[model samples]
Target: MAPLNSHSYHKVLALLAVIVSLVVTTTHASTITRRLETIPYLDYTGIEAAAREAISDTLKRRGVDESDLIARELLGPRQLSVTVPSCKKVSKRKEWRDLRYNEKKDWIRAVKCLQTKGDYGISPISDTLYDAFTQVHQTNWTDFHGNAFFLPWHRWFVWVHAEAMEHECGYSGPHPYWDYTLDYKNPTASPIFSTDPEVGFGTHGNIPLREIGQGGYKVDNGAFANLKVNLPIPHFLTRNFSAWKDWDPERHWGTALGGSFSPEQVKIALKAETFWELEAAIDGLNLTTFNDPPVVPSPDTPAPAGIIPLAGIHNGPHFFNMGDWNGPFWLLGTDWFPAGVVAPNDPMFWPHHTNVDRTFWRWQQRPGKQWEFNGLKGANRTDDPALPTDLLPFYGLGPDVPVALTLKTENWPMCYTY
Candidate 1:
């Protein structure tokens, strides 16, 4: 080989750097995929078999097979055909910890920007557009929870929040989700709660409030520490981290509050057969009374009647992070996340719910399960079918869209993926 001139030598060096960069990027991506796939999901062979039998029995009673029911139910009122949008491009959402530091900072900036923008004059309690989102949720709280709308409605809600952050605040970072399973062992110490001034959402509340009990502390560090929220009366942001407690073998599986959202729980939720079962599992509404061990409160805190021990994978993070543990009596007037209605007040709500939506998306990807939706409808939780034509009103954040449009994330308007 002839000796190369300086120009050729520099070109060769640049080529080598590009190849190394590509290799590292590919390796890192693979590692993330592997870590997610290898999570040890819980084995519930007996429960799963029972679930399948129950589904078969329900189909028999309805006098139709599963395929025929799904096909007929999906074909909603004719008007819905006019509303669905065409997909232009699909975007990938990443786990919060997977995002680069700058991406995290950008997301935080957009969220803060949203806090300053004025609302569309819809909600009396809303001081800004951000508060309006919370108001919309709070107003429809009863309708959205413990029913068919839980998963689909939240999928749309989180997407709307992301769209608002992008259009109104000029945010361009990839949508991120908090994979609670990663922090199920020790959530307070997770990077999601970092005190880092630039990227952290902030740690658990530090200033104690007597009204909210032991877990109620005003956030005192990180990017959103100074953030103030309006709705049900204005107040600075707060969080009551579920205090780490000893594991009771007879009562629960994991030690800390995070254990409620462990990988095993999520895996079991993903294994649900029907949309009803999936929603119930993800929302911590264990249908089978015998499978999950009851959560026994400390002797000092008497367990109330009808108190279900499991918080489900979806509710676990919200309850634990917001320090909304049940005691002898449930407290009132606090804006803690476990209240469910005012959960969006906390910045953590976005990523937390994003992870939830991600779980729903994962379950949807199962063979022959993408369009599997069924459950009670309306605040009454009656037997009315949750049709695709059912409207998901945005309260001026976006168009009132059909539930069908929100089903497949890769479809138009909701063109995004995990």
Candidate 2:
């Protein structure tokens, strides 16, 4: 080929640059389009005073106005100076680190108090801490999961458990939580699961020959072991340990549903930039799991690409801690730690869920996003719809608590910070 002059060579170079720019712009536009399509949309409406006027009025008589009620309800009570001279009542929930030595002791005392107390009803379930959870589980298990109601429902559960510990057992301190992300690699090794007789959740139990053969074990140690828990029948608390393993059909579960159960997963949950992504990750898709529809991921599942991942955030720690899914496991009564009706059987369920609640509260702290609730509708069943005015019915907790009022972490009944 004949050599080109400098002017022609410069023209060629400019032409190449233009081609490259067009290609880049097209690729970027496609990426934005796919992301916009894939990202789930959540229609979260702010709690309206008109919708909750009745509840607001009731709270007003107790000295809480609408805005103050809403603010404190979602975030918990605001922090005030020692001598601020205020009459507002709020419940303060603290982390484990903040508890005094005596406070820890009192917590244990309160747990024991509930453990020994009378059952709400139903004979042998009796008056123990286990019974309370069992009652709530039995009553509301249908309402909480597989919908927008999941997060708020559990938030109410945790709050009332704290209330029971305080009122029935005389615990003066707020409910404490275990931030499992801090010890993500091996949760069993953490201090929260220490062998301490007082506060620890205890280590894994002796893996029975049956369980060991099938790759399962029990959490039968620490303070929780030998502690009576009443499920269908009275039994000692149990646990088994399993490090998070990424879901792969061939390696992890041999064709079961798949995903990673790692610290990174929790971080992904916390790092969600938008509320819709956060809710989808945490609560899964708000469709009915009861029908086992094809749209819903299979059991022990993660949403495949282009599908809305259900319970993506909440599923991590459950399976990670429950570990291997090889069958004949007694604690879970199945191959895995079922996230459904019976999960609260584990005492760790409380703290694990408390951490979930904390994450929701933290997400609320983000600007322009603090006050939010699910606005989506048209599920398979009308009963499962998520509405701000919907009541989170905790049977035997006296009156029905509205979802709008409960969104705040620190409100009239609950006054504390993370």
Candidate 3:
């Protein structure tokens, strides 16, 4: 073959480079398109917006410190739900991406106050978010998990906690939820956890010798530094990611982000045609009754012929953030991130449960399914029947609220829709 001129060879190389670039871009776009199809339209839009904001916010404010701004908010007001002015219960729990500038400040200020409220006597018991966590943690051994009350019980827990932030901590915005599935591919880097110092929750920290997977680090920066989690003996919030041994991080985008659960699973759970289907998928509960033992089904368990198997969306964030399947399962005792009892100590617990509550609220919005019940009894105690009129055992809301009242998303005292 005749040798080509230098210019001809250079031209050939340039053409090859362009072709490769097109192939790469096209492949990336196609992958995103396929993943977007799996998410429900509303969730897809929210997730995409959050992802973009995470990138943009990081770039715009990187390396700039806002500790002074945070300090000012902390010193401003000791807003507690008790003394704060009474306001209408908000019906919208907007996604993090949709929050206004002032709204973000309100959340940061309120959270900081709740964490620091230990100094105040506002909440007969320490006056901090930890107060609520302890209440739930102390009683978690009961029938809350793996039962019908899982949804309603948590719904009550998060609502009251938000109120504490609002009424006690002086925060003025509705509680926010972290849709982990939005950045299921890269949760550690999600905008919700951005290290912006103003609105961010600070990125995960380095765990000296135990940094095993994608998200194994103690969150030791931003607004939640030196947090007095798990009271009496305070501890900083930590996170570690774990998943199946054979999982391919590249192929399994959603569940791959340290959670055994996936965005596809959440989508599947949302597709539940009936309340029974939604219940089973949400908590892995037995469809017939609420008396069955909580089933945390094997990673490989399949849904029955017709019903969508337990999606583990509820269990996903728990295990994703708590269980280091590849390492020691941190469930209790030492750290706030591990175990069921103390998991709520981590600030992430509020947003995590908020997402779960959002899922339940979304299910309730399905056509003609406003008030629905599938599993057996109402309360963890056998005394309560499976009646809407039965009262939930949740306290701290002044007078005990009824199951009938808690069931409706827009009812009195309970007014918020995800």
1-418 per-residue lDDT for model 3 (tens digits): 1222334333433443343233222222211112111312112222222222222232223222332232122122222222211226546897776888779877877876766644222223455644544544444334455555567767876776776676666776767888877776666667777766677776555553242223345666666644555432344566554432233345342444333345666776788876656756765444544333333354444543332233366665555555222112353234432333555656677787788888888878887556665454532235332433222443232222224345656643455676
Candidate 2 has a TM-score of: 0.65
- Candidate 1 lDDT score relative to the true structure: 0.60
Where does candidate 2 stray beyond 4 Å? Answer: 1-92, 122-129, 207-218, 243-267, 270-276, 284-311, 323-340, 375-385
Instruction: Find the 10 residues in a row with the least total lDDT in model 3.
Output: 30-39
For 264-317, candidate 1 gives per-residue lDDT tens digits of 778877887788778777765544432222233232222112222446676666
Give the alpha carbon lDDT tens digit for every residue of 276-370 in model 2.
45665665553324234333344444543333254354664555455222111233444332322445666667777787888888887777445
RMSD in Å for model 2? 18.3
Shift of residue 41 alpha carbon in model 2, Å = 40
Clashes of each: 2, 30, 9
Q: Could you tell me the TM-score of candidate 1?
A: 0.71
Rank the models by TM-score, top first: 1, 2, 3
Estimate the TM-score of every prediction: 0.71, 0.65, 0.63
